[model samples]
Target: MPSREVHTATITSDGTGFYITEPVFYAEPNYEKVNYNNYGMAFRIQAPPGAYSVYVKTTSDAADTIVSVSGMETSRLLRGGSWDAAKLVPKKYIATARGKEWTYTYVNGRDYLDIEIEPNKINTPVGVEEIVLQPIPPQQREDGSLPTIFILGDSTVKSYTFDETPMSGWGQVIDAMFNPDKVNVINYSMGGRSFKNAYTEGRFNDILMSGSIGDYVFIQFGHNDESTDEFRRFGRGSTESMYETYIKEIYLPAIRERGMIPVLITPMSRVRGNAAPGYVYTNSFINRKFPDIMKRSAEESGVTLIDLNSESVKFYNEIGVEATTAVVMSIEAGETPGKTNSGSYANGHPSKKIDGTHYKEALAKQFARIIVTELVKKVKAGDSTAAAIASYLKADVRVAALSGDWSKIFPEMAGDTTTGEGAYYRNQIEKLIQLGVMSKDPLGNFNPDEEMTVGEFIRCISKLMNLEKSTFADYPNGELSREIMGAILVDAYHAKFTSKPKYMTDYNGTAVVPGDPDYDPYMDPGSRGAMYYPLVSWQQLMDTAQIAPHLASKVKEAYELGLIRSEKGIARGQMVNGTELEPKVAVTREKAAKALYFMWVLQQAVKAENDVSSLK
Candidate 1:
């Protein structure tokens, strides 16, 4: 299908990609006009009437940057959806926050797809490169056969792009929990708004009219609700108190009268304590008021209640604070990576200061899981209030997996590979998806079996190395020999470390193969197969001809990596089992993705460790 974009500094965003400022300002730029603020750059697109996968390419990179897009809603603090769906992981890791990562998220709404990039902290710039909005004709559903789950909340429940890491909200991943064929989750939250902001603005009344009987509205607040600050406070009357005011007076009544369901979720906890074993709770005021009011309101208002406030605290305290920083915003001066191509990040945006309250995809997914579990519980108990939306939860492997263990980052497989068959790399596949390396294809499918060409592998590795440019895409596309893959990989790694990695034929090899479940070292005794080939070939009554000694090391390394079984059988996505691998065979996309993502993560972790060590 055809696609278009609207660049900043241009009129009618006739679909341009990037500009120095937000769409409302200086219709053009000469580099001197840009400011270093979070909302300085924005993308405005008129997405065609169909389902589409939206991607935002930014010039700036924050570890936990937030990619938010919507229509008909001003920016509130509440976020939506699951962490898995938060497309905020980096295409490459930089020692600094100026690293640019692309965000790929689902697009289904009115014609306008208003996408904005916000740094983890305010006043930080979200540099722009280009915005690609392509409409996928295959997934369009005009018949309204799919139910829509509308989320209304603060920054904690907002839809954040996972490309930025921990900035994602629970509402963002809700859509992934349910089958899209049955429902569409639309997050209409701004990161900072509270009930007072939402209620006073008539947001509930607005939703009441457009929503029908089958639709469900999830309302969560309190993180920003208890603010004594005048600009951020809301819903403060007696009968019109924080949690009670809106749901009792407006939401519950209207939604029920309109034949719909209104589910009330308490706010998730803030990582308000030090990363110690027994940290103090500085956010006690909110913990006390918001949840109490929410529960009371749910009881009095007769709405279904999902107590996330209590659950979040329990989970938070259990994991402790030090680890919480990875989920929230807590990068120290020397701990953060890179100092190049970044200015504002150097000055302290996303510093150890502001990330205390805002959380990311991992936290968001947990919160969503809690909410789904609570909803399912009530629905199963036959709560009249929740009966309307009970069908929204699934009873299949997806739900079972999520409910059974919240630690599993990726949801159950959606399309294929549901059965526990030859999917040894299943865990790796999910990790790749969670890391934003395995996004849905342009046609909106994650076809794991698609053939991965040599060019594609190089491009994938290039992006992982943050060396992606027009050059990598220019590589030849075809099945690659084992030696060729290793040679290309070693070259890239060699350039980064300035240490010439011995060629595949030079060093023993890297990955684990069949005979060597423990990566038993292989030595070239003058010639690789001059001895073994004769014995094996004579025993099997086959030709004594073996893999060329020069190329055989490639086979050996491939074997150790579980890439090949024989001298020519090229295996793709096998685990480190003592099994034979195929050689010189084409690799599948899943296999290629697993390999590149695993290596990238491994290398990045090592780099971060080294960076930390240098500071000490």
Candidate 2:
């Protein structure tokens, strides 16, 4: 059996064969250290003969380094990646890098892979390890005719080599779910890149250069975007601030201009343990936070959205958290799968933190299948363009296990619960949930009957309206009243509801001192002080609780817009099949969530009609 040992060797820092990290033994006068100012010194791996066809590995959660290899006739492979040990930045198959600067020949007759490691961030360690020369493969055919899907995002979407084994990205192996003869999957995602970074660093620009009209772009960036570090923050200041600006100005425009389709995707949940009984995991980062932002972007930008994050969440819930932990990057020490001739990953746990963030190949395949299933389901359901794209996606086996209803894997979604499969409001319940407008608890229970707290209702309204969380004290909590709901509804839709939210153009307009729209308001507009003493509404006056008597006018307005619903068969905002009751009745989580989703669907309908009008 052929093994990497016979073909690859690590280049050593010194002329003699020795180890600093991995196997370090190679003769090269190209590498030199450069001063890195106050923090630490920097170095470079220069080459004209620069480590041709070599696979580089970086370690310690370090995604800070960038590699630029001067291309020479002697060098076929010229890309650097995150450490395979951490299972990040999957090793390359074809020569690929962050930028499009791979064409420089004979730097003093020495082909070089110039690696410039930036000063490391104080929070984490970063280092370059094993730089192995890869065996040259047969020349690959250039087939621009085949429809290619370029994946863009973070490490979770990058392609991992077989040596990484169990830890794999769905985008890397999603090709198996399609007929390669017709569809080509090119994953350009790097570990730790925010979608914004993908554009800022020129990966998206490269796509503009390479992608043809018929090609597709799948973008799912949130993992690293959720970073607390401002330098790495992509999801930055939630939807309105960083996220909205980037999608509207950069991602959507760039992909659409090339005549290629852009499919916005949400990041999937990690197998972070600590589950409450019944439900597996309850991380809402991807479940609600990022998905909500992306969905809004897709809606405003007119792009298709594939809710992979929601689908994965459903799958995890059905499989149970314990099983999912194992399915992810977990293998009990010696329990690692038998090594293939390709190579083997180091056995056991990399650290005590556990590999909840990554998945094994088997699980990656399933997740890949889930993506295909979603594509096909949407295609058949009246999406002509999606159907056209689906024609290229030829899945046979892996997706066979999942039906069109794979998204409804959870009992709550399937209506196979205390309410039973044939329960009333089942479809409404499922729609609100499958869309992830609402989600079950970590225990895998929807708690549909549980009363909705004032806080919970505000949260649901925010999700439905895609409202921006502006300030620190902007948090919602307690039993909700008509007044609070009115305040929330008004604030959520201030952008389009009452009137299109106007940008602050004048400093003296109100109390603002300087900067127009850029001025920061430190107060929550929906707080009690703001919402109090407004005109009472018909709905509130009707409610004996006298709830929200202060904001009656706005409450009535929201009711007119059909965004509110009480537990009654026929009432304001009662778009769902049936209702619970009249106003003053305590709201239930399920009911509030259902009402929010209904409002969102209605808004989408209005948007579609407006689009048609514009076309006409």
Candidate 3:
């Protein structure tokens, strides 16, 4: 199908008078029937002061080529292409303000205009208008300085003044923080935007043009880009891609274009969950995840990243969760909490609604403080003043003391010390020894630190956990040999305790054959076996069935849950030998904390569904 071609002419105010030009075709036209070679051309002319009749004329155009003139209201049609100059009746088109108004006229063929109209505001049609216009002069400081700062972000930083309220955005707050004589803040931020959409809409271009040299531009986003559309998910890769584009395309270009500096800020933390008086409420809220990624991306991108998330977290922690909640709720309830000026329930969005996600005036001020604090440090260090503005904020360094003692640090591992090589496990081994799940060497010494052999480890875990007796009871009887071990491993595999073997070989120094007398073939021992045991010891396995994975998924789940750490990426298929489980490996407190933490999580999950019926 042939597309319609509409010729458009743009007119703008040039100095005093209006300037009009022909409509230029941006693209070549596709010809069709009716000889629509030229659809038509239209021109925009400045409406003269007061109402004036306007018409168009083409010297050689046929009468069939229609000509029309339209003002702000009425329209007129002309029969002849070229009409007698005196015969045209000019209409009254009142032009007010020093602004240009466009009037369109269709000329079948383009030509220049030399028409004249009466009642000129000024004598020379090309000179300034003589209404003795008093311009509202640009704002000036006592010292006559005009410093500029530009901000780029999503809705949070965009200017949004309430119609009847004095509420403004964080951008406005930021402007207040800086000296107007030294800082002219220009907020290029838009609401409901992401890094990608901002570029698609030419917001970056607008910033570049509006910004001046030495101007600072602060960019904060992440609430929006962390979305999964049809094309991409805001996972690590996609988020990194967008972050890079923001830096290379939007941020860096703006800085280079105006010799300005760009500061990257991680989004402010959302007020999720409840806050206490002396403790900050931190929980597994999903909205909190993306800000960390943004901070990391900013640091990796080498831009000045203001750690707003961490700062907010610190602020929350300092006031105690209850106090924070009181502050938030008080503001939300529209009753001044007498302590903090946190506004009403519109928290997440910029609206007057109290949401946990959005910030109110108080929080915005806090964030501004953080920005300025960091900004000033950079500035004092002889960095760009643009960067200094963000450093002007004062960081809230006071935080409440953490409750509880060091004992709570490893609450989950409080009672379990039997798996890794240590004296406590030695006593526990005796209990297992009596159960026949484990045995000491003939030398009268229980090598408590040795790495367990592949065969021995499997047999012990299987028997101690009753895995073999219950599930593989009908299996071929053997001396708990490699073949039986292989069968048990298969059961474990199916149960998802471990991943499938990646290699295949036999103990006889030969790859397993399907059918051979020497084929130790029930399982492939050559594969890289499970790297870490899910539980540190069989005691843990028996004590907490909640930690158990299906025999197939156990090892994988354990590794994933941080129950076990892999050595050289390989979970050796060896019995628990004393020499391998070295107690002097310098286990840090954090590692113990992780183990205990997961144990707590497991216990909580179990307790949450106490009854067997509930479990079902």
| Cα TM-score per model | 0.45, 0.43, 0.36
RMSD of 1: 19.9
Regions more than 4 Å wrong, model 3 = 1-145, 163-168, 230-238, 273-279, 282-301, 326-354, 379-616
The digit string of per-residue lDDT tens for model 3 on 1-616 reads: 1223332333335455432332332322342221222224334444321112233333212222323232111112212221111222122222222122222221101112212111112111221122111212112233455656667787566554221011224664666555554557666675556665554334443454444555666777766665553132111112555555555544564455345566777766666534323444553226436566666656675667676667767776764454333223222110110111221111111122334554333344445656665555555565654345543322221110022121221111122222222322222233344345555455444554444444454555555444554565444443332223333444544443343221111111223232347633234322212211211322223212332233324433333233333221221112111112221233222222222222222222211211111111
Per TM-score, the best of the predicted structures is 1
Candidate 1 overall lDDT versus native? 0.47
Per-residue lDDT over 118-180 for candidate 2, one digit per residue giving the tens place of the 0 to 100 score: 223443333445455442222223555677787887777766542333356777667655678
Question: In candidate 1, what are the lDDT values of residues 387-466, reduced to their tens digit?
Answer: 55556555462455436654343443323432222232343354455555455555434567777767767766666666
Candidate 2 error regions (>4 Å): 1-144, 231-240, 286-288, 337-347, 395-616
**Of 1 and 3, the candidate ranking higher by TM-score:** 1
Superposed on all Cα atoms, model 2 deviates from the true structure by an RMSD in Å of 22.6
Count of clashing pairs, candidate 2: 24
